[model samples]
Target: MQWRGRRQSSNIEDRRGSGGGFSGGRRGGGLRIPVKAGGGGIVTMLIVGAIAWFVFGINPLTLFGGDMGGQGSYQTSETGRAGGGVDSTPGETDNFVATVLADTETVWSTRFQEAGETYPEPTLVLFNDRVESACGIAGSATGPFYCPGDRKLYIDLTFFDQLESQLGAPGDFAQAYVVAHEVGHHIQNITGVLGKLNSARQSLPQDQANALSVRVELQADCYAGIWAHDTRAAGYVEPGDIDEALNAAFQIGDDTLQRRGQGTVVPDSFTHGTSAQRQEWFKRGYQSGNFGECDTLQGQL
Candidate 1:
């Protein structure tokens, strides 16, 4: 990924050193999922963290005290760090993030214009340890997430360290995939797919809801691939960049995560698709670069 010297997004809200204290609880019913975790790798933490939010409608931090049995600890802000105050200056990592976001804005805006609609660009919030969102208060343990209520994507750049070390998916493009995937969710939100899924989930059984989640997540992966397609067309992608993203998609697949964490694969509990399925959907989008081709809902998977 050749992101240097590119335009950086002005939509970023830097709250890195600001303490994200708990206040009023979750304000609205919206879809929220953590993208990274500590013990048991990304998938294991996602399962636990998802239960904390999706099932119980509470903050994941409330349940982090239990043994997660993973290699790394959840990234958190220390007292000294939290009190140090926000750093307005953009660092190397921050610049990379902003550049990626700007690229997504350009791609999605073009896609929407083609359909005779306007794209509402989402704000990306950079936080440390914990952050308050309209959906709820989330600790870094919950990883990067998109809150539909506020239409913002929240991330702790430190999660990239865990992505490379704990999850074993490294590279600038892999990091870019994380941002693109969340923006994919933002795309779903604006297109009304997210709202419909949330409504349908309310009446469905657990297994069925999980299935819906898998489809939704896979579609986001496909959307990320679409962004990759546009980015490549714009002459930003270098050789091996696509492979790095594919590897990331594989690393976080529900089946792959379950196998690593529990030594078992339970299809019914899969909120994200299998590794093959994820890669397939992503390839579909990357190959076609069409939103119509990326539909995972009614199309054969």
Candidate 2:
């Protein structure tokens, strides 16, 4: 991973202590509460959290109560933001993420330039327990996600700890792979893949929709591999880094998660492909480093 002493991004919004609550406000100089669709308010979040936690055995605290640091309300103020009362703090982990983000920007910007297109870098939001996004309010339990609505990446660094202890995928490169996967989603959004998929999904049945989502997710994995390829070319990768990332891809696969969460595997319900498929597509992207080779939508899986 060797990410130390690298450049950190300034586009980070550090809200590690904003707590969990929803209110209406503008994004001022500090933490700004984002307004978007799909927010049903606190009561709705509670109901949704209970169902997800009790029934699915997933942690619901990330949905309702974010890290128990502050009050749970959906509003942001200059003083409300944590992390030294600024948008971003220069912590070690923060530096690591910012560096990874910068690397992605460099790789994609050059690639996009080669294609005669512009690459709009995405903002990465760092939160502790909960954060409001254009997609919806999310808790740390939601994991890292890319919201096309806002063109931002949301992540709670504690997820890295969970990745190590709970998911058993440890290492800096693995963490970078997570960031790259979300950035891959951003690439998809920019490339019109997401738009076309959204339009197509509107008329699709549930099973078919899930299948399309699997392709989308797998393609994101492949895109992550592309980032890895460029990263290695830039001399940032070390020995065992690729293996760490591959193991991470395996650990977070829908099949692995389902088998661990429940007792069975339902391929029809799979949305992110199996471990083998994930690893395969990632390897494909890393080996070829060609965007066209990463198309899982038109090609057979």
Candidate 3:
């Protein structure tokens, strides 16, 4: 991906060394619930927690406390770094993240404007170890997530290392796909799809809820592809970029991850779709580059 030298997003919150404490900023006050569990390790805990929170209508925060409170400091993307224990100079990875985020902002804003609507840009919080959001406290293990409660995206850059080393999805484009996927969730949140799914999941059984969650995740994958589509049109995508993203979607598919982790594939428990479904949806959006092609909820998958 040719992301360097491009605009960087100013809506980034750098809280890398803040010890996952609370920040008294725009959206504040969340309990610091450390994620500690045995057997499944950190990644497993994250996947299970994600399924519970996203598919089963269970709020991870509610399991520990009502609201979180603490004192911490952070730096915006434009400010480089803050006085906290964070590094004084932003690194290459940080620059890449901000650049990708800015691209997403540009693409989504243009799309929204074409539809006669204004896009509300989301803040991307970069943290280390753990972080607090309107949703709850999340450890680095929880991976990158978009909190609908606060309309912000949270990521620990270390997760990208895991994505390459453990998940077998390497390349800068794969990392961009991950960021775009989370941003896709932010799109869902602003469009009311996330709210509707949360409400609908409340009355559904686990299996049915998992099915809907799969659709939602696949839609996000397609949305990520939409971002990639725009990037390609702008001549930023290099050779093999789309393939890198596709590999990432395949590596993180529910079936692939389940088989790798548990030695079995349980379709009923899949919150995200299977490898083929994920790749297909992403391809659909990438090829069409139209928001109408991303109706994973009603259209054929």
Ranking by TM-score: 3, 1, 2
Worst 10 residues of 1 by lDDT: 71-80
Q: Relative to the true structure, how large is the alpha-carbon lDDT of every model?
A: 0.69, 0.67, 0.71
Root-mean-square deviation of every model: 9.2, 9.9, 7.4
Indicate whether candidate 1 or candidate 2 has the larger TM-score. 1
Which pairs, if any, clash in model 1? Answer: 39-70, 40-70
Kindly report which residue pairs in candidate 3 clash with one another.
30-68, 31-68
lDDT of 2 by residue, 108-179 (tens): 999999989889999887776567765556655556776667788877676676566556677777778888
How many steric clashes does model 3 contain? 2
For model 1, residues 188-243, the per-residue Cα lDDT tens digits are 88888877777777678989877877888889889999999999999998777788
For model 3, residues 1-301, the per-residue Cα lDDT tens digits are 7765788888877776534322322333333445443345675555443432232122323222333232111011232221111121447677778888999999999999999999999998887766777766666656777777787787767667666656677777888888898888888878888777776776789899779878888899999999999999999887777888898888888787777777888889877788899899999999999898999899322
Best model per TM-score = 3
Using lDDT as the measure, which candidate wins? 3
Flag the better candidate by TM-score, 1 or 3: 3
lDDT of 3: 0.71
Error of 1 at 267 (Å): 1.0
**Every model's TM-score:** 0.78, 0.77, 0.80
Give candidate 1 misplaced runs (Cα > 4 Å). 18-90, 299-301
